[model samples]
Target: MKNKYSTLCYQFKQLLNTTLCCTALGMSSASLASTHSLLIAVDGLRGDGIENANTPHLDTLINGTWAAGYKAAFAHYAQTMTDAAPNSGPNHVGIMTGVTAKKSGVTGNGNVAGGNYSTYPHYLTLLEQSNSSLNTAYLVTWGTDMQITNTADLKIDANDAVNTQNAVNIIKGTYSASNWPQGTDIDALFIFLDDVDGAGHACCFTASDDGYVNEINDVDSQIGQLLAAIKARPNFTHEDWQIVVTSDHGGRGSSHGIHAADNYTIPFLVTSKVAKQGYLSGIPRNYDAAPTVLAHHGLAVPANMDGTVQGQNIRQENDKGIDHGLTTYLPFNSNYEDASGNHTHAQVGGGSPELRANGKFGTYVKINGKKEHLTLGKPSELDFGTDTDFTLMTWYRVSGDQVGDPVIVGNKNWVSGANRGTLLLANEGNGDDFGINIASSRSDRKDIDPIDYTFNGWWLLVASFDRQGVATLYAGSPSGELNIIAGDISNVGDINSELDWNIGQDGTGRYHYNLKADLDDFAVWRRAITLSEVRAIYNNGHGSELLSLMNASH
Candidate 1:
């Protein structure tokens, strides 16, 4: 029997999901049953550092969810007093509590003068409270990681191998029939590995260092052993298990705690039957881990959990999708300057990202079908991580007589096969075809039905992609709007930080897919804007109207 509050909480969550689904076309409505969630944290491991190591098992697991890479999210989130310290204390606390260290009162590694474990609630505590019968466990190699544990069912081992072995036993129900029944299962389990961090501190943190690389390999091997053990379980096939792996901050040369990118970045991987295989689209922070696991168990994340659910937005902030996470909004009101607060300046060339004006808005960029583009070199703001959802929008009128593919906006590296960021091309050979190349290991293009845009009046083109590889493309005409499923493609890839993104031309140096049309109000959002939001923008009557709505909403 559930209490009224509990029932209301569940109902409220469902209501939120329903309201959100009504807004976005590509938004996922899939729900997971309350199942087991296993979170493994590798301390002090760099996000990119795994690329240089021999981690066959870890690599194999990542392939099932994120393709082939140790690519990752940020662990050294600056939302706490730790700032860029990247210490295990604050990171692990954030991972377990879903709150900043500042709020959790676990500011530094050592116990705060008056702060106790009860200062902030752990996600496990909340989950257990939601369902008392749900089993939970925490295994760590560092004593400091124990600070985040509020439950008595905790195990600590400084040795990575022993700690993992113990975790394997616990999963196998070998810990004890009383704590873990043979037929029953653990609802949630968290395992922390510290060898990689130890190796980094002892022998240089660089990937080239044999000691550091070897430690990573060792951990990977242990992960393989654990997976094998779980598979050997009698109920393995029947159990709906989800495995999430990440780290407690990355390291620099020999130490961390700096505000550098290398020190803050860490790998985040999820392997499960329901998991999406690609790079996540959002900027995952350490706090997101707790909510992600909680959501996997079909539990409503508490309002205090300061993190984004893996596939769902717990806050429902973008339900309306007016421009929730607007990164770059190039309204082209008068110039090529970005209206989005990021102030991402565009460089005009040939036909110019800064070009001929006159549109529903004050001015527009006109691509003259020549070797011209607007380039933004390595805009870090555009690097929506692997498996993260994002939405792209632009209003444009195409020229009918185009000799090659006309790209509204795209990255040059996409043509070079890097497939970072997004390359939106339409009017291929003619003004009817529309295609998109998402960031992936290889450029996998998804084609939508040919909607003749050649010489067509200004139309609002909105495309959104989610972690599940589902893409929805919308073509909003003055008369009416049409949309189509763009088909699923590899969702695993990151923006090529080494290259430049452009507008009105392909990333290829040859300058193919030039935009031969009038463009206005080009915007990129970190989140996948819903269909209702797209309709709202189109229904606003004019470009300025929509712009005002977006500005006002944001």
Candidate 2:
């Protein structure tokens, strides 16, 4: 009996070894060799739209590469009803330069010589090292990347289309698949789409939502053609042909911005021929990706880079907690239920919670949870002064299936009813059919359409209503702040003198009422705290005592 068992064990081990060998061999074929750049960009793809579309080709392809929703540093392209900055030229430059907008010293779209160039490691390392032998060229309009001077060395800048067709045409004339350069290893073929941006600015997402979406789908189809060409080649293993699709910055109505949600978070998608083998996984910050790409190309990452490289020495920084210089709500420690498991709140999936403190004293929860979280209610409220620059902070978790309204309560000066409170910002599941609604006492204020907040998982919601009388909402900390409407309302629309703002909603001011989600440390302030104050509050949430408790429980 013992001999028979030993023989069986040996057979199983042999099978496992053989399987590993086969798998490694396969990985080497698609990955070990150099990959050809088959990059594509689809404008205005909401982070929420990633999984819903019926586009199976894209769904599968996305799984093949490093994927993430990047943080848009400065979201310009402001709007009439905007609550943030309006022009995002400087933000775009950061992407091309592989640096933060602040570090790059770029705040708008301009080719000024002093353009911020805080060099991103991935762009330089990938081109200079891994694919060092390959020739790279780009075709993009004026915006995010102004560094593309007309060097004439395999580069095309479309400052004026058709009008400058002579110049652009000359560059593309060399792109004939049949007649390619034999000596030069053409590694990357980057393409940028800037038309939808115009639509967002002229029509606002309200009227141009369909147009914006259609434009993206159209670009996707065009990319499908490019993918087909790469696949038809002998050297290309379909998987060896790397396809990356992303935008330098997000868009909104009337203006671009840095502080808007749409402006801060950008889409990142990579589809390789060797998918199914499964690609890199886990939710990483936007900055982390540049380093990851650079590493894959066998290049060294710069230490000063603010982003991260996944699956490496770089760990996921918890900006949500105190350790990372944040304050406010408790660092979204971990998902928990009642000790007796009887609080009755549903389990949240596909999304997590983000924590933030108003460096002074308050919390902001960007609640996007699909299900309800049995959390602490608005047990407290304070007067966030009328003449002060105040900021609101909260840690919210977005539902994987929806972006629900779980925040937005009224104060002494809200709602028409003196005793009424409006808790807006919850999920209708179907779409933005629901939202968080807060009203002030006076009027002349523009109805702010929160620059597209995250509908997927979690992020810190930071509201900066400057004393200068403008409001801005940020995803994480005030890495960037946008301008929203912030003046006293004159009764016609101001609901400031309402009742106790409810989280689940009592059907007060907006379309959303019932909050099927959880909320924590919902706080207020008398004045808008400084950015550093916000960081301190974030840090406070994850106090040594609290972290130790969280870790022990985990």
- For each candidate in turn, the TM-score is 0.50, 0.47
The prediction achieving the highest lDDT against the true structure is 1
Q: What is the lDDT of residue 423 in candidate 1?
A: 68
Can you tell me which runs of candidate 1 are displaced by over 4 Å?
1-34, 65-84, 112-119, 177-184, 311-554
Cand. 1 TM to true fold: 0.50
40-76, model 2: which lDDT tens digit per residue? 4444444422322334446545433222211111111
lDDT of 1 by residue, 477-508 (tens): 55442433233444455555355666776665
Candidate 2 worst ten-residue window by lDDT: 70-79
All-Cα superposition RMSD per candidate? 18.5, 17.7
Which candidate leads in TM-score?
1
Those runs of model 2 whose alpha carbons end farther than 4 Å from true positions after fitting are: 1-32, 49-56, 63-88, 116-126, 129-132, 143-146, 149-153, 158-185, 206-208, 272-289, 310-554
